[model samples]
Target: MIMDLSKQVKIALDYIQSIDVSDIDDTSEAGRIFYEKFIPMAGEEETIYKIENLEVPSFEQTINIRIYRPSNEKELPVVIYFHGGWFNAGGLESHDRPLRKLANLSGAIIISVDYRLAPEYPFPTGLNDCYNALEWIILHAKMLGIDLKRLAIAGDSAGAALATVITRRAIQNNLNKILCQLLVYPVTDASLKTPSWQEFKDGPVLNYEGAVQAWNLYLPNIKEIENPDASPLYSDELSDMPSTLMIIAEYDPLRDEAILYAEKLQKSGVAVKQLLYKGMVHGFFQMGGIIDDGNRAIEETAQFLIQNFNK
Candidate 1:
């Protein structure tokens, strides 16, 4: 272990060691299942009043979305959530508990977006699904009883990358309603050459080689690696972007990039708050089943949105 991980994470890693999915390609069926095993814990389901699945139309295909409403209050603020899976794995089900807890804690309706994965759908497809889903939500806000004027975008890891891209796209469209972001240990850069990436080269959870593989699977065109839409860290216009709450894990391979992005956001005069979890590794934010910090990340991150949304 590169860092002193939490006891909970230590035990969780021990269980991970017992699994045979390590050698499997992450985009493979068994590999995706391996990612989910880390966070086997469920949330306080009673806290959420409703969980419904719906679909959104995009140019390429129809994407699924799971809505989590803690209450039936009229015109509630909402958080559009994208699940983390390196743009290959992860889905609405894997991230359900964290979204539910955030919805309950923030008193905001949380919508989990089921954007398409990579190695099949690839770049722009998933991004398009997420961006179009946001547009759909904005257009149908009244019917859904959500306050379109108060909206936030959130995601972890690869999904977080999509969330940032979506927010940037929303800004370009002059959509000021999308005003806040909750990025949990996001993949801000596609270069995958940050110092932390090298530091955690062996990974307690995510490693540099694994990240490279994910990027390879995601971006079909190598020339687009530095494109702003493909990698938000390369985007020059950050001044008018949404106020952000960046969640970071100290031992994560992507740690330095998150910090760099936070610095960029601050330098651009955007409102930014960073919540760093010491003694933690990558993907810990959604591991509530094994570690208390997973839920703590949700609880702590909820207030940022609540305050931003004025809920």
Candidate 2:
């Protein structure tokens, strides 16, 4: 039986439900309004480091990147993060608290990337921005006072897809510097017929219709669905990718894809660790103030990154 959510989770879900659903019709207007109004709702407490906006390579646009630096001043690991919004929504501002907590918990520097949204820039554009961010982080590790060899990439939902794709591209280009990847309820495949999609078609937070709309924005066309850059599940290589830590919400629509990706990674001889939190729905990670389970998952993720990368 599914467990009832605690009061905090209930409140968080209430806020989540209050956010307007993205309409595929007016991509920019709906997306902008939803993010401007909704992103700030996720708490962002003042922290030790300064948040700065910077431009990255391979793109003409100036990306918003936040850096949370520890006061200890010692060299720490760097985690480059992307926020979930199905490619059409979400940005650096939306995922502030989660990223801050991750930095605080892991005792690492967290760099959150604000890549371009889709239906405007489309595939490879957002993906490339994230890749450039990775490259920028690696190149400027010294200035950031982070250990370049300990660099990792992480994200939730669609951002998670970007994270995985960046890791694969890093491997293909022989950028051999990435140490790990953290994926939370990631959209691993663009083929919308998975059993999880059927079972959790109307599940809370992220539903089938919302997911399809998001995919349409990211993919922009049918032909791109099979491209590995847009869908990492179709990628021919996984053996050379970094070690992976994937978190899946049992009730999420994307659970099966998360599971299948883990299996494929393991089969391909890549080290993969998966955690399935039962009775949880998609976007639980962002509800830390409401869900005890959300806090627990974040803590587990922090520990996972610190423990593995500390090796």
Candidate 3:
């Protein structure tokens, strides 16, 4: 379908298209400037009850995490969040606005994890950091005012990919702490050969070339692209995964893989909610400050969280 872009998305696309990324390097100063320029800042939300910054001890280094609470509700459910940026860029500050909004809207505490990025830490390092953070959160749930049984994992793009990996690991270890996963246009397959990849290869936001670049930077070798840990879509088993809410963009190169993964999860008897935003491009979920659809998606996600947490 040739869906027309929403006004805000059109503006976003215009802004993105006008950028000169010819000299940009994904690992250097140019990447930093690009991230700062493109990633929308949501500022602050008045509804948030509290915000805290703390560190979690990981295998080789200390990982920083930001906690956002909507209200003074004790033992609130928690959403562990990982930010996008193709796993090479993005950190706590870049995603702070959405985290706060999520905290307030979902009536759950939001823990934004600042996991290590790629080309430096590489594939499993960031994933390992996320898993370790999950472990720490669960172990110290009480001290953090979190309800162990009401935990959820959430992320956008590469972060969504990491969330899926963490959820899979949690199931394999027989840990039932995670109740649901909120994935926003997740990068589920590293193959980068899907039909959508061909369709949106140039991207309104994320292009196929950029996607490949990210995977190359994240994985140690090309062969690792097929590893289920690196690409959750490659996993043979999807059964027993936590309930899932997947938000996909029709114009995103990663769209098809997200749909395929959701289908797989549903067929595996996992509860799945999928939203395909027509005319939307990748990363729309984080552009709420400019895109109306972004806020709507967030509201839907918050409702999903509240419903699942109540269940």
Candidate 4:
């Protein structure tokens, strides 16, 4: 058995190592291949509310949204989620377990959005779909029994980047419906100059090269890659963003980016809290049962959401 760490942390690290490491380095076609194989290994859990996929009328695209509601009849706050796959992979199937746990832990309605992937739909497509889904949820809030004033946006990895962008777009558009953001190791910068990138150049799960590959697929163009909407770290206006809780891994490549974003948010007068889990790597929160840190991260996030939301 793996030792030299806490019981939970060991399990999490083992889970990370147990994943097939062969194709992980191949960023071209192998990235997709790894994800196709990785999702099934993620495991599952039963959710409290029924899930349904819906399409966006504006884009004429079929966007998958999994809605989780409590057993009570009252309208709860809505948490819109985007799953992580470096913007190229991950969907409803890969993230179902964590969303379910989040919904139950926070006692809120969870709406998980399967935004369009990269290299095909690219940049604005996925970001716009997420924002559009938020709009749809607000327009039909009454139907979904949702509290418009208490809505929040959340995501991991590339999804987290999308969440921050959506929050910025919402704020800029005068949509004051967002209450807070739960960002789990978000990729804020695309310049790849951050120290975290160099330190975790060979880190597990989300390696340094994988980061570049994902960005290449999403942006595909040199100019568009540096756009603030595509890379939140490039944005000049961090003000007007809602209260945020950013969870970072001590040993992950995106750690500095997440920290820098938190610093920017704080400088902008946005209430922000940063939680750093030591000796942890990327992709810990979503890998339930396999990692103790995953469970701990989920509980901490749920508590944070319950406290700041609707206040």
| TM-score to true structure, per model | 0.95, 0.91, 0.94, 0.90
Q: Model 3, range 147-255, lDDT digits (tens) per residue? A: 9889899999999999999998998997666789999999889888889988878777877777777788898698888899999999878887888999999888889
Cα lDDT tens digits for candidate 1, 1-311: 43677788897778777777756664467767876765565434445899889988888568898989888899998899989988988898788777778888998899998888888888988999998899899888888889888889999998888999899888888865676999999898999879998888988788778878888888978998998888889999888887899999998888999999999999999989999998887877767777888878888888788788774
lDDT (0 to 1) per candidate:
0.85, 0.81, 0.86, 0.80
Clashing pairs in 3: none
Ranking by lDDT: 3, 1, 2, 4
Q: Ten-residue segment with the worst summed lDDT in candidate 1?
A: 38-47
lDDT winner between candidates 1 and 3 = 3
**Candidate 4 residues 185-240, lDDT tens each?**
99888888888787768775667777777788888888986699988988888878
Deviation in Å, model 2, residue 35 alpha carbon: 4.6
TM-score of 4: 0.90
Query: Candidate 2: misplaced stretches above 4 Å?
Result: 1-9, 20-27, 35-46
Q: After superposition, how far is residue 136 of candidate 1 from its true place, in Å?
A: 0.7
Could you give the candidate ranking by TM-score, starting with the highest? 1, 3, 2, 4
lDDT of 2 by residue, 1-311 (tens): 25466566567667867887555567666766665555443455647555566666566656768888755666788888989888888877778877777888888888898898888888888998888888887778777889877888899999999999998888889775789999998888999778989887886667788778878877878988888788778877998888899999887889998898889988899898999987788888886666777778889999989987879
Query: Which residue pairs of candidate 1 clash?
Result: 41-289
Off by over 4 Å in 4: 1-30, 36-44
Residue 124 in candidate 2 has what lDDT? Answer: 80
Task: List the candidate 3 regions with Cα displacement exceeding 4 Å.
Answer: 1-3, 18-27, 41-47
